[model samples]
Target: MQTGYADHLNLLCDMGELISVLRDSDDIHMFLDQTVALVARHLKAQVCSIYLYDESAERLVLRATMGLRAEAVGVVSMAAGEGLVGRVFDSLQPLCTGECRIHPDYLYFSEAGEDQLLSFLAVPIHRGAVRIGVLVVQHEQADSFGDMDVRALRATASQLGSALENARLLLSLGGGAEGSAGLFQARTPSLSLVRGKAASPGCAMGPALILGMHRCDILRDEAEPERSGGMACFHAALDKTLAELNALQERFARRLPESASLIFTAHFMMLKDPSFRRRIEEKINLGLSPMAAVRAAAGHYIAIFASSSHAYIREKVSDIEDLACRLLRNLKPGEGKDAEGVKNGGIALAGELFPSDVLKLVSEDVTGIVLVSGGLTSHVAILCRSLQIPLVIVEESGVLRIPEGTPLLVDGAAGNLYVRPDDSIREPFVRTQAAWSAAESFTGTMSESTWSRDGGRVRLFANINLLSEVPLAIRSRAEGIGLYRSEFPFLIRSAFPTETEQYQVYRRLFAAMPDRVVTIRTLDAGGEKVLSHVDSAGESNPELGLRSIRFSLLHRDVFEAQIRAILRAAEGSVCPRIMFPMISSLDEFREARSIVYDCMTALEKEGISYHSAPQIGMMVELPAALELIEDFAEEADFFSIGTNDLVQYMLAVDRSNPRVAHYYQPWHPSVLRALARIGKAGRAAGVDVSVCGEMAHEPALIPFLLGVGIRTLSLDPQFMPAVQQQIQTMDLREAEEHARELLGMSSIASVASYIGVEKRA
Candidate 1:
């Protein structure tokens, strides 16, 4: 093994020990003191201290120390951002430097007796995204800390933050006047407010429907207990939980975007980790019930993750908590369910929810969802958006303290949840909801022909993934179906949907649209959406690998079945159009087209009464597709710009990855230029061009699309009215001028400013 790899493994082992110490300790002061001492020993540093932020005072007080004078522990305090230690907490990043005493930002505290220290390292300790404290280590020698040493210190700080928060919570509960009884009493005001990321956009006012909480009672002592039976029970519950997770993963993979299904995969991996399983087994052997063992083990990891400063790592706590709950409930069935008094139409409140839990809320017809723990990109959040249900993630612990059935108002657009909102606040939200409903009704009545103020006409189409959405498309009066994702039926089914089954589905979709054009993109499944029956090793980076047209061509039987079905569906009245997705090169598109031709010939030989060959097109999603647009325009019947993937590929950013999602800009000058190039190519070849990505729904981008000469747009049915409103208000000439100016802009901020300035005018 490489020396660096060995060193990393050793560091991880040490971190595990540090975590054990934090989890086992109960006293806050002793825990803090031991943490500083252990950190000083681990790094071979001369001094280590922990400074916790006092929110009320707006300063960091020295809570624990190893090398400082004993008297300085409680007395030493610095204003936030005033000293080296404070700066770490304020910036939420680590700082390491030699000759720290000479730095411009250094502030020496005489009482701490640290004048001799030359090298210093400080890392912020946080609970998830919230800053809590700073962990500092100092050395008498210059340049004492290396990169590895800094990393070790940071990991220790994360554990310390979580442990401290847990200790504080216990302290509050134990020290209160009413002791444990005080825990149930609401600490938050009657009119409380909390903010979270807006997973979906809408507004609703209803009573809070709190979900049932899971609890496990640990039996600490039982002499001569049945250890083997407890272990057996624990393992059985673990197996069941894993099975449930696998099923949930598959369900989410079918119903939601590929990114949304990853949480379950992560949970599955966590469950399989030997160390985690061992921890639960150890607890089981200690005479605890099977459910208690699972809860205890989960809590240990949850506390460690909950204290982390990194949002990504901290988010894992929720997943772990959910898994623990599932294990407990599996061990004792019918334990976790909705509270008895929960009524329909109320906003659902929960500490966390799995994808299945959210589906239950949908069945109950809940008006909104407020989760105390969940990320904006979680599967449940995605499901809520698809169901068009408002969801808000409340981060404050006080949210749990709010009484069940409390009148709550959820502002999903603003990411705010109000507890017992007054008449003044509720009145405006009611009006807003009414306005939205009226807008939807008015948009449904809009004419099928969409025209700009300057008489430039654009065909508004609907993007549908399922047959259920066809009615909404019809109601919106869309001229045609722009992009009908044909992968949904395949994804949702347990096995490959038979050729007859696919034909029937296509027949239904074609019949629904009738004479209106229906562009069905051939099964674009691969990458994140893998078939269970396919024998394939998953790609390291699936996005750029075997997907879309490539997958269809490789799996010829599947491709042939879909093509035959599409052709048969077009027999009499339906004018079906077939579009191939993720086509980067002309050869790939040609190969896919040849398969369709082969299918048509086979249908003719079989005496199948199939209609004429449909208009074949390619989805312009890759940067390579844009470059070869003119070449493709020669043979292709039409080109639909999938701005979602195109922008991501052009910018080299994964939109689903939170770290770089901000860089996935549709307004980027390069993306605009590419779109314009495709538009020119399509117009020159007399091929119809359209955009069917989320960009089509954005009203701000409608003018730009018109300016780029795109004459057709396919989007969600709900967005048609607003986009039509924006289009009707626009003058084609002014839009072209604005588009030209926007293309000249260098940055996203500049383009946004230009648009904002124009909107005000």
Candidate 2:
């Protein structure tokens, strides 16, 4: 074999092994140390080091190293933009240089022992759009690192970022390390304060009602002590769990949005996985008791998912744990009881919570929720937001020692939980609540139409994802429904909802707001939000791949069912507008419209009463859509700019990823330009344009949006009053001038400064 071919094959084998170790390991320190050693050996580099970004300190701290001083692991730190490593993080771009010492940005860290190294290659380790750290490999010889070396480092760096995040979460929850008795351990303090991600924005003070952790004690009896009876018991337990989950799903489906109820469906699917059941059966056949077998099987899968490098997969660990506990409780009847003595207006505290548990608390009149280990995007968080409940998530270690029934103050908006507070501190909270109530009453009396000081008016619409939110929209005095996310019904169900079911939902929405215009957006699923019944296979990049309109068009059966339902519901009442999501091209829009026409024709042939033709629109979320706005405007009735996706795709940032969230700026000069272009094209084509994403509700951005000629703004119902109040105080002429200056600005800092200065004036 040729030497080059032999070397390439060796590289591939090394990478495979490296990735295997990275994926299998759950310890962050171990993973980083192993990574540096592997890279240094495979690439023939003199040194390899990983530096993780410390947000609190705003510096890059050396976390692991190979062929360098071992003592510098946690001590050496560099400010962002301070050295070669900092430059990589600041630029969020790779840097390679044959002459490392001569670089202007180079900073000497004697402990690193890189004095003899010449060639250097550094790549930023990013989790989605967020830059978490930097990976650097140095060689003793100049020009030693090539493109292949850079590529390999980048792949490894990506894996490292994901693994690091998973490990951090595990450590925070006290799940990965040994000798940790509980999820958290709080240090003694005068008044313990636990900080967490703000899931739902609100403030509430109440006594702490700690929910007990339920675990089924496993007996060490011989495996299959009762032989065939053991297998029977396991199967029966599984069946009962599945039935319970189904019942829970049905109950939640009635009250919450279908999306919230989908959590149960996921748990139900897990119980049905053949492999998961087989694992337990194999253990049971080995003479293990059914309960023991179930515990072992669940532990195995939980470890695997918890060690995963992907954030989405890592999150499933919580679900698996929840399932295991439920199954165990089912297997051992009378072993665990549901949370009792939940006081009205109490803040429920738990190490972890499932969607069902959160729903129960809500029903018990629990004022707020505080979790030790739950993601901001979890189903429980979604339910809390929908129910308008305050939710704060603190690290387990921070609040593990707080006593039950202790008076506590939870500020979800600020992401803080006070263990106990004195009257001086608590008094401010009471005053704030009173002031908020006054503001709410005042805004509640305002008219639906919002006008500026300069006599310019903009219609305020509500963006709702669930049919249950219709009344809230009406209460907010919204002029209309700007964007009704039409995917929740499909998302939460075990299978596709029948046309009749879809029609009933749409009819209820129309009935709730008979006088207002309702714009229903078609199913936007298949990316982060996946459907169980749909085939989401073979799409390597779901975000930019078969999602949104692409998924709907490919699955014409589902699309037609939805379209037929919407058409039929609008037959006798005011015709609601239909908007297609993620329309990137004129051809895609036309094809979707064609499908709608076909659905109408089919309904006509069946002699079903339906609105044959209704107002059609497209969401301008993609840069491609912005580029072809003129063509789309000519064919569509109106355009709604989905700024969330528009900014994400345009900036090449994933908004959900914490590392790159800062880059997903709505006020970027380019984003502003795109909005302006869409507004201009809509005006030219005599089409109404609306801003419907979260950006529309931002008070700072509201002035700019209005100034850009977008006369229609849709936002969350909770934000409408605040936005209206801000609008009533703004002058359109001043806003237009501010927007013009903002359009010329290049940085988010500049935009923020302009808004801040204007607000102060």
Candidate 3:
């Protein structure tokens, strides 16, 4: 609002006009060089520099400069919050100082020749929540910069945000293929090993199928008049993409588990989102063609998603790009053929893969995937795991440039990739592969009951996540369903499912396994598995905060609705058991049970047919419940040992945190003691006890569990045969003797050493 500020604003606008006239063919480095020179001239400053944030390194890299030494352009860099530029970026505010040497956060670099520089002004450059970089100006004289200077620099940076983002995206996508020589760096595969994160656990050996090599040239921002039929063309493509997604979702639901099928639901939601459509429409209204409009809109979303610190949010970038690519393919057929050359029984090598792309690979029977972008917990990685496909995330982008048909062996369990391996590597993996294939055939029939050599029977149940997995459980010969995670349905949806919707899902679950016990856990929606629709946010430590049974009690209406759905869905079912998770106290268990009774009563008053006496149980997963097992057993009908949470809570380690994941040992002495104590208490009180966590399916721990009197074991359906085979190999007497010796040990190392197979030698 000052006269000088108004004049400076006009100057910034003039700089924007100059930037707008620049063409797509202009080099990004040239543009940055010109912009900095113009800013220095306009502001009458000694130096002006542009520092961009490199997300992978978490550093502010100096990209261009006007007055500093030319060599320092790419060499000078600092970590976020390491210097004055970082302080401005961290605070997202303009910073000006008259005496740069006296400032506490000032960082000096000799290569920049800024020792004599006294006046400094910096402003954070960002678009919405995305932090792009920082723009700074310097002067030789003290107090040379003023308020007008800061305001002008800030305005100029704002105008540069969009152009910089577009340029960056174009450069990254376009620089890969200079010609055939650069694209095909290696004609013959070299012997080498690359390491990455293990996404899904398995081994795969096959020829590599290179993908994502096509650089669609639709991202250029050139002047083009809007076509007359652009809206119609856009709508036709939109409908086709939606249809393709629907078919994909249906195919996955029919063939894969519900979790894998729901990966496409986000695609469907985005296509139907009003805001996404509005963005494209706005671009079209601005005289751009339909294809260009979609690209511009998608590029905006991709930039925002790629800038996020949260891994989950950042994963959305692929989904957005996939949608745009699909739309462009529909808009103009035959172009952007990135996946055209893929074949069956091959390994997919790419920079990154979308969720739909993963499903397509599964359909084509691709053996494994080697990605340069995805994390272990990403949606595509989860889909690969659910589909039993091997996936490894490597940092080696050169794999994309490797010749087609290169023999690549992926060790998903070890996170290693062997390129054109010799017999030394091939022979062992071949034997392992043959042995795995033979074992996976699962010669044992599912109808036969499993028993130890000492004649103690052990029941095997399936831990179901969705209704689609019920058939898998039945085919695997699981006697019943245990630990049905009730939170997954809530997690996938944008809003809480209504009672009718919940009842329908539950009905399908019970109808699939008639006359068999199905232990459905109540809403365990907190901690790491927070519901998007619920107001359970801002907890510093969510694992110890309102979660599990505590969360169910706090939101009693949600608990009762879920209870009512379960009760109503179990009208004709013989054995439907309701279980509560994370019960830390006696009062929590009592309150949850009281709510179950209230739901039953309310259903009866409404003249609805419902089960009156579904069995109630509690998961003994906390140390408090482990120590006071007798008290909980006295009040509860049965106990399910949720070993995943029990081990995490008892050891005070976040199993999901990679830094402390090693400390989450289920084989620890105290964890074993707690399991043994719970089994003893349950037997004393005549309460049926079951192990329904990951510990149940572990082949090494099955004997120990039976020794501790845990007769019922629940696990993933895929592991049922292996656990059954392990049970058949063990004698209950030997297991009991081993359990006695193991529980007597005080140290974890002693327990591990005593049970280790090498110790027997």
* Residue-level lDDT tens digits of model 3 in 672-716: 989999999999999999998999977667778888889999998
Query: After superposing candidate 2, which stretches have Cα over 4 Å from the reference?
Result: 1-191, 212-254, 257-345, 423-432, 453-455, 490-501, 526-542, 655-664, 729-753, 757-761
How much does candidate 2 score in TM-score? 0.64
Cα lDDT of model 2 overall? 0.75
lDDT value, residue 405 of candidate 2: 76
Q: Which candidate should be chosen as best, given TM-score against the real structure? A: 3
Please give the lDDT score for candidate 1. Answer: 0.74
lDDT of 2 by residue, 1-761 (tens): 01133443465566556545545644455556556766676676767888988776788988777655554566689987888999999888899998899999999874454656788899998887887999998876788887777777777677677766655665556444442322112233233466667888788888888673221113212242332458888888788788767766666667764534345655777887889989999999998877788778877887687555454565566577677777766666554244223566689877557666776677678988887555565567766876678999754322433577788888888888888887986899899898778755665687768888778888999899787787777878889899998876675444677788788878778778777789899889867766645555567778988889998899899899999999988875565899999998988999999999999889989999987668999999998888888888899999999999999999999877765777777777799889989998999999999999988988778888888888999988777778888888889888888778988887767776777733111
Q: Which model is ahead, 1 or 3, in terms of lDDT?
A: 3
lDDT, residue 82, candidate 2: 88
lDDT value, residue 123 of candidate 1: 94
**For residues 543-614, could you state the per-residue lDDT of candidate 1 as single tens digits?**
888888888888888889989999998777556799999999999989988888888899999999887668
lDDT scores of the candidates, listed in order = 0.74, 0.75, 0.77
